[model samples]
Target: MVILGIETSCDETSAAVIADGRVTANLIYTQQMHATYGGVIPELSSRAHLLKIAPLVRTSLSKAGIELKDVHVVAATAGPGLIGSLIVGYTFAQGLALSLGKPFIPVNHIEGHIYSGFLMNPAPEFPALILVVSGGHTLLLNVRSHTSYQILGTTADDAAGEAFDKVAKLMNLGYPGGPAIQKSAEKAVRKNISFPIADVKGDYNFSYSGLKTSVLRYIQKNFPDGVIAPEEQSEIAYGFQESAVGALIAKTELALRQGSYRSISVAGGVAANGRLRDRLADLSAKYQVPLVVPAFEFCTDNGAMIAARAKALIESGIPDYGIQEPFPSFKSVFADAPLVKRS
Candidate 1:
């Protein structure tokens, strides 16, 4: 069965076609309209999604060499994102499903990230641990099966990716700070400047706001005259990235020790960070366990991940909702839906 997935949960307007568990075509149009503002403007993002959704879906189907009518089911992100943006995709999916008499599946944004590992790895064993770090979310989940999930840890304040963007803005770097800061840090020399890593005493909870403030204070104390020189800026970026990745790796290592799981998976936009991936790979080696990190394209928000996850849900016997409901903060496994095995 071919599932058409739509994702307009944020600044990116994307769509994709997936047959079974493989992505056939994926198309994403990132709205750069927020670059000038240094952050996303909800109204503008929603408008842009409205303008791009239909054409993007058509393009995705065409790229897959299939027509919309061939899609047996429809899937779209239902919530935990901008209300307006979620509405755009949800409404479109609902309309299409009703018109075609196909099932409409609701996918959680975070769950989509977790399932991203499946798309890249394809055969990950059950009872795996997943870390999801993105601009708005940082969470660690324990997956027992295709439909069972337990959240082990999550950020209490600012997400790791958000900190990256904020630090980039402070450094006069362009928008979407992860890639830019990574590039700058690559050319930087490791400095002795120290940044605090939030070591909250717990099993797996995380706090990044303190680390972000520490960066601000470090900048103020070291570069009191304002605006750092190019060399100094690179050092600061390098230092900051190290601290953030250190905290993440430390927590993940601890989680692995506490949980019975042996496999680790990392997802979300920040998962695209080369340094973080390397650190996780090292950790995986140290623990003598397999680690799954999706391809760079799957790390960011995209329709392919959504489509791939939806296919899994359907094959696993999760029923579809005929009407779409915008779940702004829904949290549950795909098994929450009634199962219906197809012959």
Candidate 2:
């Protein structure tokens, strides 16, 4: 099957083509406009998607050496994202499906990330421990299969990426803090100033709000003038990243101990972090299980992941095509969606 996938859930305008379970082409256009504003402005994001989605789809299909008519399935991220952005991609994909009389699959954005491991040469096995952390979400799941999951833990407050961005803003590091912090931390000569890892007390649950505040308080207490030295900035960035990733690792370690998982996979944008990747690799090594992390391209929001997930849904005896409206609420989107048979 040739599937065309569209993702406009956040700041990215992506389109991808997959033929018979293998990725043929993937294209992602990240909005640089958001950097000036220090974060994504949802309105701006949707408008940008409207302009880029069609061209991206055409380019992706062209790169895949296929025409629109060759596509058998039309897939798009349907929800758990910016409502307007979701509508742009969802409606556009539906339009394409209608024109071709092809099946249209509305993919859950997070589910797309969880199953992104399938994009690798050897996909993750069932009963894998999956960690998905991004700007809007942080979740640890014991994936029994593509259709069933036992939610191991979730953040009580700020999501991992959100915390990174917020803390970066506080330090004038940059917007979308992950890369900025990494760059700054790289310059540090010493990484001693440590931030506290939160104890959520709910077994494997996570909490980063406390850690975020600690950074602010540290700045207030030490740099009372609100001006940090160059050396101090790097050290602070290094310390914050260490603690942020440390909290995630701590929770993941707890979850790992509870299951007989054959593999461990980390996804979403934060999966792109070098520190977290190294730490998780160590944890996987300790457990003697393979660690699966999406390639940087797939780590961020992308249509390839969505298409792969839609294909899985179709293979699982699911009537994969449908008209699903964009869900704006995070709580309900996550709850009512994914069709997760929680164990």
Which digits, one per residue and each the tens of the lDDT, describe model 1 over residues 29-84?
99997989888899999999999999999999999998888999889988768889
Ten consecutive residues with minimal summed lDDT in candidate 1? 334-343
Give TM per candidate: 0.94, 0.97
Q: Give the poorly placed runs of model 2, Cα more than 4 Å off.
A: 321-323, 334-340
Query: How large an RMSD does model 2 have?
Result: 1.5
Over all chains combined, what TM-score does candidate 1 have?
0.94
All-Cα superposition RMSD per candidate? 3.2, 1.5
Best by lDDT: 2
- Once model 2 is optimally superposed onto the true structure by TM-score, how far is the C-alpha of residue 94 displaced, in angstroms? 0.9
The C-alpha local distance difference test score for the whole of candidate 2 amounts to 0.89
